[model samples]
Each structure stands twice: as C-alpha cells, then as structure tokens.
Target chain A: MNYNLPVLLIAIPILFSFLSLILGSFNKILSKIILISVIIFNIISGICIYNSVLKNGNILTVIGNYLPPFGINLISTYTSISFLILLYIVFLVASLIFVSKNDDRADKISSVLLLYLASSTGILLTGDIFNLFVFIEIFSISNIILISIKDKKLSIKGSLKYLIITSIGASLYLFGIGFLYGILGTLNLSEISLNFDNISYFSKVFIFLFFLGSIMAELEVFPFNFWISDSYAGSKNYVNILLSGLSSIVALYIFIRLFLTVFGYPTFISFSYSLPFNVKTLFLTIFGLSVIVNELAALSSKNVKRILGFSSASSLSLILLSLSTGLKNGVMAAMLIAISVIISKPLLFLSSHQIMKGKGEKNLNSFIDGFRRNPLFSILFIIGVFTLVGFPLTPSFWGKFLLFISATEKISYTTLILVIVVFSITIELFYYFRLMHKLFIKDENIKVEKTKNNFVYIFSGILLASIIIFFSVKPYFTQNIVEKTTEDIFDKSGYIKSCLKSGEIDDR
Target chain B: MMIDNRTLYIYSFIIFLIGIYGAITNRNLIKILVSLSIIETALNIFLVSTGYINGSNPPILHSGMKLISPNSINISDPLPHALVLTAIVIGVGTTAIGIGLTIKLYNHYKTLNVNRMGDKDEL
Candidate 1:
C-alpha cells in the first residue's frame, strides 16, 4: 500500500508538462532540464512501484477516499507495471534524442511529450472505464498535436485524418460506456466485471461490439489503420518512435485489459447457452487479414518510413493473433512478441533516421552504401531487421518460436494460421533483406554527408540491441517474466477480489 | 412521438446512424467534422438519458431534508450526468482540434474535399 507511487506516477509528469511550458517561456534549457528530470523521476517511480508490486502484489489506490464502484481507482498489476517501466525507458531515450537536436520548437515538443507520457500512464493505471475514456481522448489529442508539430502540409493532413477518425471511435466508445452504465450501474472496471453476468444477452453482445470497434482503431488492426502509414511518414522520426514503440504498446495493453479482462470469455461462456458467433475466431480472422495486408503493403511501399510503419502494424497484428487464442501459453507468447517489438521497433526507427540523415530522399535508394557511411548504425539496422524477421540469436526469434509452439498446442486451423504467418514472414524477409543488400551495395558516386554522430541516438540504439541480444542468449529470464504476467492477466477472480477488497477497506 | 425511455434510446440510435452515414458519405473535411460532432451529440444524449429515472426529482438535497436511509428518496442517477458533462467538454476539445486541422489542410491544399487531397506521399 505505497500510496504515493501510483498517484505521483501520473501527477508528476502532468504537473511538469505545464511547468515545462511556463519554464520554457523563461529559459528553454530550463524546460529541457525539467523534462529530463521528470523522465528520471518516472523511471525511479516505476521501479518503486515494481518493487511494491513484487512485495505486496498489485497496488490499488482509491482516489478521493471514496469506496470503489463509486470513486476512481488506479491499479498496478505486474503486467501494467512492466509496461510502465518499458515506457519510461523508451521516453528517456526519446527525450535524450530530442534534447540533442537544436530545433526551434524544443520547448513545445517537450510539453507535448510530457503530456503524452502522463496521459498514456494514466490510461495504463486507471481502473475506471469512464476514466479510461478521458485518458484515451487526452492520448489521441496529444498524439494529433505531436504529429502536426512540424507544421508541414502532409503531417497536418495525416494528423487530421488521425484526429477525425479516432474522435469518432472515441464517441463510439463513450456510447458503449453509456450502455454499460445503464446496465451495470458502475464505472469501476472490476465492479463491472463482477456484475457483467447480470446484463442481458443482447446488451452484452452489443457492448462487446462497441468496445471492439472502438479499440481496433488504436490497435492498428485492419479497417481502421489506413492512416497509420501516412502519419508515420509525415511525423518526425522521434515521434515515430513514440507511435510505434510506446503508444502501440499502451494501446495493446488497453485492448488486453478490455477484452481479456473486462468482457472476458469465462464470464460469457457461463451465462449464455450458445453464442451466435465465435468471437475469438472473428478476432483471429481480422488479425490474420491485418498481418497479410500490412506486410504485403509494406512490400510494395517504397517509402522507408512507411515500410517500417507497416512492419510495426503487422507486428501488432501478430501479437493480436496470438492473444485471440485464449490460452495461457498464447498470452505468454503474445507478451514475448510484444516485448521484442517494443524493444526493436524503436531501435530501428532511431537508426533509420540516422542512416537517412542529410539525404534528400527517404526511399530505398537513400539507403545505398549505408554501411560505408556509418558502419555502427548499419550494423544496428541489420540487427533490428534480423530481430524483426525472428532470426536466431535475437529476442524476436524466441518470440516467434514460442508463438508457433503455443499456436500448435491449442488452436484450431493451426496449419492455416501457420502458413499465413510463415508466408507473411517470408515476404517481410524479402523486403528487409533487399534493404540490407542495398545498404551493402557499393555506390561510390553517392556523396553522403559525414554528419556528426548524435551520442543519444547511437547509445540508445546500441543499448536496445544489446538488451535484445542478451535476452536472446538467456531467454529463460524473459520466459519466467512473461509466464508470471500471463498468469496475472488470466487470474480474473484474483483481480476482482483484490479490487473489491480494496474497495471494502473504507467501509470497515 | 411519445418520448419514453425506450423511445429516447431509439431516437438516439437513429441519430447515431445518421451521423455514421454522413461521416461515411461526405467528401468535404468540414462535413466530416460536422458528422463527427453529430455522433458525439447523439452519444451525449444517450448518456444523459441513461441517468433519467421516470418522474424522479433532480439529484439534490434541500435544507431540512432528513435522510433516514439510502434509497429513501427517488432521485435520478447523477453519475451519468457527471459523465455527460465531461463528455461534452471533451467533445468540444476534439471539435476544436479537428477544426484547426481542417483550417490547416484547407490553407495547404486550397480545397476541403478529402478526395482531392490525393496521397500524402505525393504531397
């Protein structure tokens, strides 16, 4: 019951966001210092919460001293705390890279980054559904602003599309919340889960549909992610790291929280005599199509940023595909894949910008003789690609291996999914290897600028790569962590009991 | 039309569908933004309506009212009203951001038609 950690984790960054803005008006360097200090504080708080969770098992903080089912609450389980820690690390690296650049709008960017961190952390920690909606809006608005910070025409258009579509999705989500409130009479997540079976069959199905449709946009699944490539290509490279690395992880975590935890299958299976359609199968088909379509699109795309964007989307789909299996092992495999993606995607993005520095074009042609220009970055990029393709001695390899094992163990149509995954992986390999080959191809006539190496970029890239390699070499450590997280996610009764017990404390 | 609880839900649903239809069919960026606002309005109405109790008084306590026990008085649920207030504020913020983006897009392309903007890569 370390009361300060959860509230401070959310409040500190938010307080600093405004503080940084005012401080930036006085001195820009002061604002940057505040941003760095906030991130460092976030890391320390994240570690403290992790330690508390290890000792005390899931800390639930009730806001305003009101009992649960009435007051807003924040819960930090092992899974959420792990994601928070990972998010802090990525933000630390991204902030360092941002400070290294001498952009005119550094103060503005620092404010937006802090707000982004605060809202996303709020989304992860809040246990109330309505609070989740508020956080989602903040997250989306900040994301749009972040995308449009460069004030370029394309970035504006991209952010416009993103804003309009995601706003509509948020409205749909609010509508779903209305229905849930009407039926369940409470906004607390665990309270809703406890009373979920009391809802009528039709209402339950509709609520589930609304939630799925709303979240699918952020998840970057098929039908709602057409704007993703544009946004990725239009924004600055560090923003891409946020979009691909940090935000996507949070989005997936929210999806898991809603689907696997809130409207879980265990509750549904008991109340309903028979389901009209298989929900898991439906999710599987959507994710399957997402994987194929995104990978194929990446294959045809010539823009370097767009290709990486599509690859990130496809990786998200792969994680979703594994999660739809509803087996413990599937959840484990999904976590494994998600961790590797969270690690390597940002590395690739950071290094891609480095490799494309001083280049006029962002096409594959720009990558020619990349190895000659900066050998360290070229090697880092190759390692990133290899990890993405799940080559041996990379963390992604173990993820894919565990995924294949888990998929074969419990899923129907395993061969069909296996084929789709393998086929898509091969297509991905073709394009990635082609890029690697272009990097090695000698082009002496290409005058590459000998740009000074940004220590932040190189250090972050090398750090992530080394982490990936270390995990690959000793995957048992990761396996044990993922196993525990999976158990935490699957323990629905335990989650409810803990939340309700915390809620009951005030009454006694 | 008699406006009962069920009827209110029906009206909101139809409005929501119209918003969705408009959002899908409109080519102009402003029209799309309007459609999104309409959707938000529909949801807000639905949410506020959920808090309504038939013939119940507004949620308030007057002086000299003695509370004997919980549920002693019939009052409409105030939680959904609070939620709707927040929703309306958020809706305004989103609309403002959308309008800002629209202005920027119009200034850049000199047109509001979504189709005419062409591919972002080509821009």
Candidate 2:
C-alpha cells in the first residue's frame, strides 16, 4: 500500500456517499449495496493503513500539494489506525442491520451513514485544526438527521435539543479556534503545539476552556450530556449504535488525541508545557460524579432505551475515569472498557430492538417471556448485560481490575475514587441483573407469538458476541495493541516529526 | 481611523456575549436558532479580524501590482478568511437543519415555545 491510503480511507466513503444517493434514487437496493461495498472497501483500506503504519512507523498524506505546515494532512499512527479498525468493524455490523431493515427513506439513511463514516474517518485521521472543526460539524449535522429520521414528536424534540446544544458547542469550539489562530497564526496542530508555550498563560487557560466546553458536549460527559438519553430514547436502534457506539468512541478518541498531543503536560510529553491546574484530578472528580449519578439514573429509569442510555453514559464516564489516572495502565483499562462498551452496547440495542418489536411500550416489562419469544436474542442480551456488569470472563472485568490496580498507586483521591467506583459498580450490577431477570420471567396465560429471528440479526449477533467472547477468552490479544496505542499517543515528538517531514513518504 | 485589532476583538466578544444571552433567555426554538446564527456570525467576524493587517491589501496578487519579494507583499493573512468561508457554509447548514427540526416540532405540538412542550418524564 502507498502513503495515499490514508486519504483514500476518507475520500472513498465521501465519494461513495454521493454515488449511493444518486444511484439509490433510481433503485433502493442500490443504496444498500453501495453502503456495504463502501464499508467493506473502508475496512480493507483500514487494515492496509494499520499494516502500513505498523511497518513504516507512520504514514502522512499531505493534501493539495501543500507541505504539512501549510496544507491539510492525514496522519495514520498506531492510535488512529487501531480506532479506525474498530470503528469500521462496528460500522459493518450496524450496516448489516441497517441494510436488512426497510424504511421509507432508506436511501437517504444510507447516504447519511456513508457521510457519517467519512466524517468519522476524517476526525480520526486529520491533522489540521480547522479541518477537524469542519469534520465535526459534518458529523454532528448528520447525527441530527439520523436521530430525527423517525419523524415522531419525541424524536423531533430530542433532535431539536441535540441541535441546539451541539450548535452552541460547535460555536464555542470555533471561537476557541479563532483565538488560537489569532495567537498562533497557524491552523496546523503540530505547528501550534510546537509554539504553544509562547502564548500567555491567560490565553492558554481561555483556549483550553473553549476546547473543554465543546468536547464536553461531544464527549457526552455528565453536565453536557443532557441530550443523550432523550436522543437515544427517540432514535432507532442502529442509530443508537451510531450515537452510543460510534460517536461516543470517536469523541473519546478526540478527547485523548487532542488533549494528550496538543495540550498535554510535560510529564506526558517532554516538550509539551504543563497546564496551570491538575487535569487528572479535575477529570477524576467530574467523571466520578458522572459515574455515580449516571448509574443511579440507570437504576431508576424504566424505559429500556433510557436505561441503556444511562448505562452507556456511565460506561463512558468509567472509561474517562480510567483515563484520568494518567498512567499507561489507565489507558489500557480505558481501552478495555471502551472495547467492552463498543461490543456490548450494540448487542443490547439490537437484541432489545428485536425483542421490543410488536410491543407498544419500551420498558423492562417488554422483556417478560423474552426468552420464549426470541431465545437467541434473550441469550445474547444476557451475555451483553453480563459483559457490561463486569463478569469475570469479560473484558470489562479486566478493565475494572486494571483500573483499581492503577488507582491504588499513590494518588491523593485514591480511596475516594475507589469508593465511588465500587458504589457505581454495585448499582450497575443490581440494575443489569434486574434487567436480565426480566428476560426469563414467566408471563402466565398469554400465548405469545414466536418472533422469528432474521438471519441478518443472528449473523450480526454472533459476530458481535464472538468478538466479546474472543477478548474474554484471551485478554492479552487486545492489550498489546492498546499498549502500543498508548505509546503512540505519548510520542508527541514522533507525531510532530512525521507530520513535518515533507515529501519523504510521497516519493514512495 | 482604521480600527485596531483590540477594538475588533472587543466588539466581536460583545457580539458573542449577546448571542449567548439570547440563546439562554429565549424560549422559542426559532429564536434559539437565530441566536446560534448570531453566535456563528460573531465567531466568523472574530476569525476574519484575526487575519486583518492595518492598511494591507486583501491577500491577492493581480497583474497590475508590481513584482515584489515574498516578504514585501503587504497583505493580510488569507488563511482565516478561508476558514471563515468554511465556517459560514457550516453555519448555513446547521441553521437549515435547526429550522427543519423546528418546523417538524411545531407541526407536531402546535406550539413553538419550548416550555409549552410536554413535561419531562421520569425516564
């Protein structure tokens, strides 16, 4: 593979999204075919990029013939490539369900999903600050369209709220970008990082605050996450995968990528200057509150989607808390938890979607006699919830284990965070088991129609389940990659050098 | 007299604050969207002003201009101008979507006031 593969990974999906829309106008099946093909093509390219990065150290593809500092560039490092692979895999499974299900606007949905794929690819790969902003705008706009596609009152309401909140977030981010550009006179992330220390301390604080406001909304952290439950409750199941599974992971990736690389302290990156405050402690406090509050919220909620929404939020906070430990092990733990969430949340959403069919209400009671109706779905649901609650064989268990081990190492807030974590886990276990219990509860005197499982649903379920089981059986497989990714994230000099080393990769 | 960069920054900041105040105080969805647009415009103004250089020409080279060294080309930075263009397009797209959602909500609820919508459920 050539160095152009990084850009191709972004361009192909965008090209295909438009193609699918134009073609799907003629025939609906064409859009489905295009979505699958585009995703498959992306997966192949993602693997190639991964291999190329592993072999060639890092691949930088400069756009528009401009050198790295002046032009747009895509950097495919170990960290980004790994996340890209995981994202495409999730997209593939979600597309399987998306393709199988029929909707009046299937063509539009296909195109939007394709655009989402492109925007996410851009988010992962781009090295330019302004380019990142543009892709984020596209990502959120497409997200708004997807959430309200159902056209129901609740969905519209949720989408409207999401629109308002995200618009504000995006605007704040723009203001931040304006400030940065005004001070730094360059839009390139590496160049900015190189000159970050020259700026005044107050400017640094204000810029970082702007970035925090925006990322907090996108990251769906506690205070800025009011849009999530309502939006998740109102969106379609696969879109839930897009929101909780895809977007949250991407947002967290953004949080890590930007914060660690651009604004990281000297302890993390030798050249980067330390921030005025302790970011780790701050994140811990905020994320700890998010964990406890979200889990309690989940425990109280009865709507299945809202419960799952709260659960996903709690898992995201748990991942963030692990990240806040600011240790390699903490990142590894975060990866473990993130992987578990990316796998299990989709499984839960898809299975619950199948189980909730023909039921007027979306609640835990909808799962009564669920096993009798759709045995495969119920079993999958059990495994998913079990994985979430940190069953011993699951990756979440390993994640929580690693988190506690790291948390014990000489942090001032150790016991406090541990207590909060323990309390959160206890609540999680209670509620998830309560949900699983409802799956097997016998409903008397009701002759329930046996719900037929679509082959596509079963295929996707098995595919997702085997991923969880594979990691469960062998946790070390992903641990190595996560370790390398953590190293890649910390290697700020290497990132800057690769992006700034002009035309060497191009000759190849 | 040509406005200095500090004056431009302060003005834009005030405009941004006004937008934020409007967004926070407004109960109507359309009003909120308009506030968002105002915020976008303020940011764009701030961004474009960041590229400003007093008495400098627009970052353009026409045939009538005498050939000069690269350092001698007295022009404002063009990058933020380009950035503002992109931001404007994005702002337009976001506003369009916001309006579409507002229309849908109004058709469903027969009211535009956010508080008039149904109360939040326990879920």
Candidate 3:
C-alpha cells in the first residue's frame, strides 16, 4: 500500500542474502529458512504493490529523496509487478528444489539464489538506464557463478563461455548508455524517452544498434547466443529453470521497455530522413531466423536439456517476432506466450530431472518407461511439453492463436514470418512428441531401478501444473492481466509522465 | 595543443573494437578474459570522456561561487564519474570471477586453450 514497496522488493532480498550467508554459517537449515521466508515476503509485497498499482496507477519510488531525472528511481508498473510475482513464485519453487539437494554447499547456493532474486527484481523495477546495466551485470555474474558452482568440468566450461560473452555484451551496452548520456545528458529512462526524438538520426541509429546488439546477446537471440546450449545443458536442472524461465523473461522485458517505449517505435518510423532499411523487417528476420534455427536444432539434439534450451530460445524468439508486429494483439500474444514459458519451463525441467534420477545419462532413451515408473511426473512432463508445443487447453495454444490472428491482420512479411514460424512449430511438435512417445514406450527388456521420489519435485510439479491447467480452464483469468500489461508497455507517454513528474505517489 | 573529443572518441572506439576482436579470436581462456577487461576499460574511458567538459571546474561548490542558473550548472557533470566508478567495481568483480573460473577450468582440462579442451559435449 506504500510507495516504499518497490524499494523493499529489491532491498529485502539483498539484505537477506547477506543475512542468509551469515546465518548459514551457524546452521545450514537457518539459511534455507531465511531464503524461503524472504521469497514469501517478496510474494506478499508483490501482491500489495499489485493492488496499489491497480488503484493508484504506476508508483515511482525515488531513492534517498534525490527526485526524478536527478536520482535513481524504481517504477512499479502493471507489467513489472506481475512479472515480479511470477518470478517470486518460480524462485520459491526453485529454492525448494535447491534445498532438497544433498550437497555440502547448499548454504552458499541459497545465498546465491537470493542474490539472483534481488538482481532480477532490480532489473524489473528500476527506471534508470545505468541502474539497469548494473542490475544486468549482477544478474549475469550470479548466473555465471551458479552454472559452475558444482565444479563439474562441463559446467565450468559452460560458465567460462557465459562469462566471456556476457562481459562483452555488458561493455557494449554501457558504451551505448554512454553515447545516450553524452547526447541527452540524462540516464533516467523516462527522461530519455521524452527527449529521444530530438537527437540526430545517426546517433539514434547507432545507439539503437548498440542497445539491440547488447540485449540480443543477453536475450539469447540467434546470432549472439553461442553460449546458450552449453550453459543450459551443463548447469544443474534447477539452475536451468532459473536461466530459461526467469532470466530470459527479464531480458525480454528490457528489450520491450527499451525498444518499444523508450525509443518510441512510432517516432522511429515517422522520421523524415530516409532510413537505411526497414526496422520491423529487420526484427522479423532476426527473430524468425532464431526460431527456425533453434527449432531445427532442438529437433536434431539428443540431450534433453539441450533440446529444452534450444526450445526456450526459439520460444522467446517467437515472442519477439509477435512483438515486432507492433500491434496491441501482438503484445497480448507475447504476454500469453511468456506466461506459458514462465510456468512450463520449470515443470518440464523439474519433472524431467525426477524422471532421469538414477539414470546414467540424460538422453531420450532414459525416458523409456517413464510413464510406468513415475506416472504423475510423466503426466506433468506431458502437460509441459504439450503446453510448449501449443496443444489445446494450454496458454501457448492461445498465444499462438492470437499470434496468427495478429499476423494475418498485418498481411505482409509478417505472414511470411508466420509461415516460417508455423513450419518451425511443426518441427517443434515433431521433437516434443518424440520425447513424449519415449515416455510411453513399454520397454520390458530392461529392469528399471526405483528412483527415490523427491517430494519437493512432485509438489512443485503439481503446483506449476495446476497453475497451467488453471489458466487453461480459465483463459480470461490471465487475459485480464496480460491485456493490462500490454497497455502498460505501449503507453510510452504515460510512462514518461509518471516517471518525470515530481512524484505524486512518492513516500516522502 | 589538445586532442579534440573526436580523436578521443575514435581512440576509444578503436580500443573497443580491438577488445572485441581479441575476445572473438583468442582460443586461450585467459586471453579472452583479458580482452573482456580491456573492453570494460575502453567503455569506462568512453563514459568518463562523455561527461568531460573543457575548461570547466570540477563539480564542487565554494563560497562566493556564482551559479550559472537555477536549472543549468557551469561545472563539469559529475554523474559519469560516479557511474564509471561503479562500472570499475563491477568490472573487478567480473574479472575476479573470470580468474576463479579459469583456475577451476585449468584443473579440469589442464590447458588454457579452448580448442584443446576437446569436445566433451556431443550431439
């Protein structure tokens, strides 16, 4: 109900991360308690902020009373708060999976997870551009640490590659921010968006390209995503959930915020200077290529996690493709698809992790007789895979439906992209169904060991599955939020006014 | 005689490009990490120079100093200096992590060259 809630959302996790580290030194269980309690607190605060934003509109909390356009501020809009809630839920589930591990470094992992939560919350809430860069670095560094913390050779290699790529991306992004700061003399996002149009066309294009290059690397889009498959496959199963589900969502949020709102796409197209090429067409080609390449890669990959990694890259790219259409319907579709990913990715990884327990290798044949051994988990896996492939009674189905509808309304290269997307989806279908078919194979030749069932995995799987099924049973439940988030993203002027105005909702 | 901002900009850009080239081309992990740090330093230089104003006093207030106006100030912008400090701190953190990981990696593969790490991952 108060304006300090945004700061609390970021600060609490950070404070507790250190507290968790200290407490874990005394008793490892204490650290797990602190981690869960902090995530629960985040969910509660997120609900309060969501309620307040619904009543009072976007709330801007300027830090240390420095005021907007001069000081750092956190903006809690409809889109960001809802995603914060989703991320908290996912983190809570992930922490549970993480807590159940038998590793001696559990305490340290808890602290890292809490730090990841804090940085992600910061990335979502901050309205300052340089602050966003800082949060992104924290986010990426934490990810690099998590990927290799187990010290497996494969994971260390993956982590090394991630470190190099992200470091380069962050440097390029900072350079872009510097370019903008030199030109506009401000780092507040709303102020930049307000004054973005006055800059010379060349500077605008250069800055945009820099921002795009950096974010695409972060977003795991086609050209700059060399680190994805190795990192995804090499990390722990729970870590894969955080990487594919939470981090990609936050990066996509940044992409939308910077490209659609701050740069003002309408102003971009309406520029009187003759453009070098069509921006929308460029976006469509990039994302479309990602979709095609990743889907085809997913189809050919033998490793399950690698397949999921490639699938997630393509799914996020499809979301980007829909977004490039620049229609309200397209944004709505993107929101639905993102929600599907945020829910289903964890379920797939969690269930598959359970199914693969006691198996020597994480491959397709390992899934044989999965239904006979762990029926509930196999069912959950089916739901997750179906949701990914856009079967009926799933949010992804509706997302793809809306995507097709929106693409048809445009009736141009979008249709061509849509055709490519549809072709990719068929490939997606071929692979996911192949995975599902492995689950049901009645293999009588081999004696399967009874793997110990992790109740945490089962409980989290059911929880995530029910969320998907709930959304499927009641599509409108999610649509209301998705529609509002879409509007919040597109309302660039409203964002500028709220951010630059001497805060009406300021706590001070 | 002073070098203009154009030359400085070009210099930083060239440094940035060199870092990128080394990062992409180097097969040794430590070399790649060094390239990344080079890139970070180049960015910090670019950012600090962006806020530099010729012949302007550092952004500090003294007694009897006249303000340019209510909204605009006569002193050089201090924000980029603060930003570059934070960026340097972050760069240090990243570099430290890179070194730690490299140590772990060397223990595993016994080689710094990425090409010699061999294909542990397969299709």
| Ten residues in sequence with the least summed lDDT for candidate 1 chain B | B1-10
Give the clashing residue pairs of candidate 1, or none.
none
Taking the tens digit of each residue's C-alpha lDDT, what string does model 1 give over A13-107?
Answer: 89999988888988889888998999999898899889889898887788888777778889889989999998888888888888887877777
Candidates sorted on DockQ, descending: 1, 3, 2
- Enumerate the candidates' DockQ scores in order: 0.76, 0.67, 0.73
| Candidate 2 lDDT, B92-120, residue by residue in tens | 99999999899888988899999898835
DockQ of 1: 0.76
Across A334-442, the per-residue lDDT of candidate 2 in tens digits comes to: 8888889988999999889888878888988988888888888888988898898788979899888988888777468679778977998899889888877887888
Report the lDDT tens digits of candidate 3 across residue range B4-122.
56677888999999999999899998899888988988888888889777666778999868777934666677889999999999999999999999999899789999988765454
Best by DockQ: 1
lDDT of 1 by residue, B79-98 (tens): 88889899999999989998
Query: Which of the two, 1 or 3, has more lDDT?
Result: 3
What is the per-candidate TM-score for chain B? 0.90, 0.92, 0.87
TM-score each candidate.
Answer: 0.96, 0.96, 0.96
lDDT per residue as tens, model 3, A120-214: 99999999999999999999988999999767877888888888878878887998999999999999999988888888888888898898889
Give the count of colliding residue pairs in each prediction.
0, 0, 0
